[model samples]
Target: MMVQIENKIILVTGGAGFIGSNLCEYLLSQRNKVICLDNFATGKTSNIQHLLSNPNFTLIVGDIRNLSDCHKAVSGVDYILHEAALGSVPRSINDPITSNDVNVSGFLNMLVAARDAKVKKFIYAASSSTYGDSEALPKVENTIGKPLSPYAITKYVNELYADIFFHTYGLNTIGLRYFNVFGRKQDPNGAYAAVIPKFVMQLMKYESPIINGDGNYSRDFTYIDNVIQMNVLAMLTENPEAMNTVYNTAFGDRTTLNNLMEYLKKHMSQYDEKIASVEVIHGPNRAGDIPHSLASIEKAKKLLNYNPEFSMKDGLKEAVDWYWNNLK
Candidate 1:
């Protein structure tokens, strides 16, 4: 059975973004009070529009980059799921300064606030990109490689800060290194949009989806539902060993980009057969991108009892259905 985190005031930073908004909605459904702090720079208002009506859901228009804003959001909160960060490797590559400001500086600000607020636990979103330049397959929690981009460096810095907060200030923290997460409400219109959502949007319109390389890059494409489950587990787990460590939040499988496109087309073809005929275009590989990513969920499974219920194919089908109905 899934552990329940109920009746507590939970803060979700970047709560207007894709994953953060979903976490807010779920927490509210479980009878918990949810405080969402967002600046809406990249987060869309449309994402959390429905939840605005709920009294249990409080929206704070704030930026994490500001220390005062972090303090305000952390006030009277029992726990925090810090999802606010500047994602996208290319964006960080183009402008490293802004990324560092929001990701590294903002993360430190949150850690300080969480410590001061005496929050029970601090669970923040880490990234698989921290495994940059590592040729190892089935990435383990302890092993990592040198960061390849500013974004990766920032995310790695988050884990470091979380660890120090735990040791120096006696804060309980967990960092979830999320792989290629996708599903409903993931914005498909952005220069830095994730591959799955971007491709799904294009295929729905019968537009040719461009592959960055020869289309063999594989990823452990995790479903949003699975990610949600992991977050909740990270929050509620009573195991002391589980505390003050990071876990790879993934579906424990890999799918090549070519296979991913084929899966998307197969799922979408159910609505429009012509989607199968849409040709895929190839382009140069993206900078700061690794060729393959897979995760070893054994650590998470044993420590947190994380049993991901969706394979890449299953998640892809669900995502296709959502985009077809909503984005179309």
Candidate 2:
């Protein structure tokens, strides 16, 4: 059964993280009742601190790895947005077991709880890394290469399990394959920090930023707003064609790392002129890194009517302005 957005009870796991927190705020603005589940591993309370006062929002500090917590979080929820997982390839490469525990086992636990609770729909955060080693430009939904890292494997497993639940148990599941999502409230100090926020932070401090692999490697860097839109559409979409399918949630454009640095510097320079002169250091390609990634948003558009509002340049400007004001 399709669930309406207004007044629906929604559970967003990892709702205190970058994308999750943004989703929480969006859902609440729509007047939906939202429950946020997090163990605070990578998520911070500060992300959702502004929304804490809203009566429509509730926070549960619990690990998804625990079945009881999953059950507890899913209770009385009409929709489930599973976003809690250990992210980053390097983090997984260093500790595959913990990644497995959180991304794989924890995902299964959430699936069981959501299914048993008879939730109307289950939407999850899939990754573009699942297109690992495929050498294909503008990756499509059906075609994918073998996963390159523990993190990639975990995200791939999410799609696989979601498919299984749909076939076997009649769970309505949709996976949104996110590509390099970035925006405000994104942690800039973490060791596995994403490119945009990290670069913005370094430039704000007038520090040199590192460009991996000569900055030629490009990515389909998505904005947090686009991801939030996809989640809402996934949960609210009533089109039979959209249900139980994976859609690439991206802008369908590519930006090279070198070009991205130039753009970032241009934007940051508006606040501090010295930032425009900051040199970017080059480094070797990191392991489990893709040479390039671009998503074909045709599926999302045809199925979910997804129309991304921000391009790379526009999204970066907003992100840079946010980091400049908040971090500095």
Candidate 3:
């Protein structure tokens, strides 16, 4: 996947958020002009504050719900990594309208802008929740089930719209259906914070972490680097088969909630031994929560030649170190 890195203007919507910020930083390191569009609703200034002074970095404070904002952001962008959306199943479950507005309507706005701008490609953040209610192990790209949550519905609609754009307007698009992603810069606060970061912060504080189910529920829990790699390949790939499709962006492994806590405790304990003594509590399985989730990344591996560099253990250890040093 080592093609000559081009000096193109790229727009990362939600570039002030966790994954988008990381992508922005990496793109900047490669000396590309990066335009970041965010409303700061979920995105934070702290994430992109480090890049404010960089010559190639620009942040447009705007919402994607406004087609004008999307048009303004995409004006000279060579590619669009459309990561702007309201994430979190619980959040979507609690307020489907807001999530629908941002994730659905906002996504359409970006697509129209990208198509009108004639961007080279549109790579977006799809979700593993698209596999909703399916009882299959190692979920594949084609075999999908009925969506269980409003969040899943929005992500699935993204794929459908992406397909239509390619067919109707010849806009190339790729959707990365991410699993339980975790790594540095991921927020550990807030009610809808991801499990790994939330647990790491709780353990660091010597507080209890609640497992939603009986601790048997598992997830692929992909690392940010793996996700970044998938995005890059999606953006630069020349294979026609790779276009107008979706791929599972994951580490291709699963860890139970209990096992995840053990790893977090073990890694964070290296910084503060008391974190190991922190108690873990269990609660009733959350509503709309699935028992297990795993992805078959063979499509990405074969099509995108995606070779994930980090395993879940490798990623967890690195994430713990970053949190320990940066958050504390």
Candidate 4:
């Protein structure tokens, strides 16, 4: 049975962010009324500025750290997609306390608010970083290792509290462990910028992009469209085996940094011929970095009927086009 999400009042926390804004746009396109809560901490208003005219979209500028703000945002909402968090391992390493305050404490505030509101289901953006130091090829939900950073610890804690909420308070929740998601609307001008967007931006300017490792580290570079699909499926799924469980939301493939650089250089050269000659410099491996990551999405497949529609190559082409047209 296919789940139809129509006319539902959904609260999308951090909807001004890269993933959150994309999710809000998708939900609005589906005829759902979306309330976007964001503090502009890491999220930018430009991401959601275009959606301001949509009648189905409501924007609330507020911090998640405040319980009253979360309480107000979750009110009268049918579902909660908690996407507000301080991401990036280096950022967390630079300031562990602030990261914990936002990712851990702020997460609890949202959970409490959603539970009180009696929202149908709560979905959050978990991370593949939770599989830190495991050395596992294809990471499964139940199998994990010791967290390598403060950011990893914060995300794993989200899963812990979510499970306790289900068992102790009977609040239904789902977590999607995302692996290296990238695409349109992703910010490339930040100190904690992700690899794909940053690299693309650097290449567009004909600048050398730095590879953080020996160019051998690999990741499941998921596209944002696929992430949107996973979120929608997690929220709408009615399968008895699906609720209260975490799923790995990835394309079930991996790409090394070196190969990814070559792919990006080839793709970007189509727009600017000079990009073909861009050099990539290798640097020391980053702290709290994983060597390789791949996801076994079988659980998401069987339980939520999640069918990822875009590969890295296909998604990157579309993303690069968007960046070329918009980010200039």
For model 4, the stretches where C-alpha displacement exceeds 4 angstroms are: 1-4
Instruction: Give TM per candidate.
Output: 0.99, 0.98, 0.98, 0.98
Question: What does candidate 3's lDDT look like per residue over 116-227, in tens digits?
Answer: 9999999999999999999999999999999989999999999999999999999999999999889999999999999988888888778899999789999998989898
Quote the positional error of residue 183 for candidate 2 in Å. Answer: 0.6
Separate clash counts for every candidate: 0, 0, 0, 0
**How much lDDT does each candidate structure score?**
0.93, 0.92, 0.92, 0.92
Error (Å) of candidate 1 at residue 249 is 0.3
User: What tens-digit string does per-residue lDDT give for candidate 1 at 127-231?
Assistant: 999998889989998889999999999999999999999999999999999999998889999789998999988987889999989999999999998999999
C-alpha lDDT (0 to 100) for residue 251 of candidate 2: 96
Give me the displacement of residue 220 in model 3, in angstroms.
Answer: 0.1
Tens digits of per-residue lDDT for model 2 on 48-158? 999999999999999999999999999999999999999999999999999999999999999999889999999999999999999988899999999999999999999
Which residue runs of candidate 2 sit more than 4 Å off their true CA positions?
A: 1-4
- Model 4, position 280, has a per-residue lDDT of 89
Residue runs of model 3 more than 4 Å from their true location after superposition = 1-4
- Candidate 1: regions farther than 4 A off: none
Error of 2 at 61 (Å): 0.6
